[model samples]
Target: MTSRSEILREKMEELIAVGALAPGQHLDETELAARFGVSRTPIRETLIQLASMGLVVMRPRRGALVAELGPHQLVEMFEVMSELEATCSRLAARRMTPADHVRLLAAHLACREARDASDPDAYYYKNEAFHEAIYAGSHNQFLLEQTRNLYRRLRPYRRLQLRVRDRVGASYEEHDGLVQAILAGDGDRAEQLTRSHVMIQGQRFADLMASLPQLAAGELLAPGAAGRTRREGAPAP
Candidate 1:
């Protein structure tokens, strides 16, 4: 079971991910502690945890703020993620066991269900499981660990991407192709398909930017704007 700190951290992360906690917004410990009905200790611990995940920025005197990635950084991270996923797919094609194939198919089915339901949040978790199955199928412990770490860091952004119009359907189609390639033991095809599926460049990147305002408005808004407050350079929450 998750502890209160973990739960609070996840809630804060969701707020940031959806833009409820805007970029550069300071995290006031007192407010957060009051909001969550907890003491400042758990809030502080949660902030530290989020900082390590790249979702929170902790400055010398600025305390904690939501981390924001510039356009260049976003592209660079996506590029690395694409390549890592491609490598995993390639190795998985060659090394995956029959049981691994079964699990991958199950994960894909779960994603399809979530997509059909038009549930982005559900699809996001299912998507994570799908990719994780591929990582495990790669049969390389070090590579799996690295991929999982990066995947976690990229989770919020990736989840936002799925909110793009038609993205869920398109992603499901891509997963279908990737699953087939890996199952058929076609490493080259699997690598190419996985890379294309994940690389958010060209038209895809443009589309993401176009959709940002909508995502920020629809998903990121707090109950009342006035209820959301931040202090610059405040003490650690």
Candidate 2:
């Protein structure tokens, strides 16, 4: 069962994704508590959770606000996420046990089902499971935790990527290749395939930009826009 904090976080994320809460909008604890029929305690906790996910920014005196990453910042995040995922895949190829293989295969199968059903939301959840399997198969606790952290931070943008034309189908094919490489215990191939699968570059990045105009009536920042800077204290890795 989902905790109160988790439910509140999900609702807040939906609001942001649907543009009901624009970027940099202040999150009033009292209002959210009333909206969710909970006390301010859970709302406070939920803001902290969202802050850790990079979806909310908590300033020293400004309280909590929705995070708004500029295009360059978003790309920087994707680059780091790509490397983390590639590392996980490489280690997974070397360390995955029989049970790990079974779990990963199951997740892939579920992703296939979601794709075939043409449900982007369902596919998005399954895609998360598929990556989680890879992270677990790495068998490195620190790496798994770190990758999961970055993965959570990138979740919203990753979901948006699926809205790109034919992206879900292409992503499924990439997963097939990754699974085959990992099953063969080919760490090099697994690293390469996973990197390509996760990295938003060239045509894929362009396609993502093209799809964003429909997201919020030009509210989303375009690449090369002025005043775009990386998040303070965010690691460049």
**CA lDDT of every candidate:** 0.79, 0.78
Tally clashes: model 2: 0
For model 1, the run of ten residues with the poorest summed lDDT: 228-237
Top model number, lDDT: 1
The TM-scores, one per candidate, come to 0.84, 0.82
lDDT string for model 2 (1-237, tens) is 756566567677655644455566788989888877899998889889888778799988878987877778878988998999999999999999999999999999999999999977567778888998899899998988899778766655776788787999999999999999999999999999998999988998888777655544424323332122222212222
Q: In model 2, what lDDT does residue 233 have?
A: 19
lDDT of 1 by residue, 87-188 (tens): 999999999999999989999999999999998766776887888889989999888888876775665568678877899999999999999999999999
Question: Clashing residue pairs, candidate 1?
Answer: 29-237
RMSD of 2: 7.7
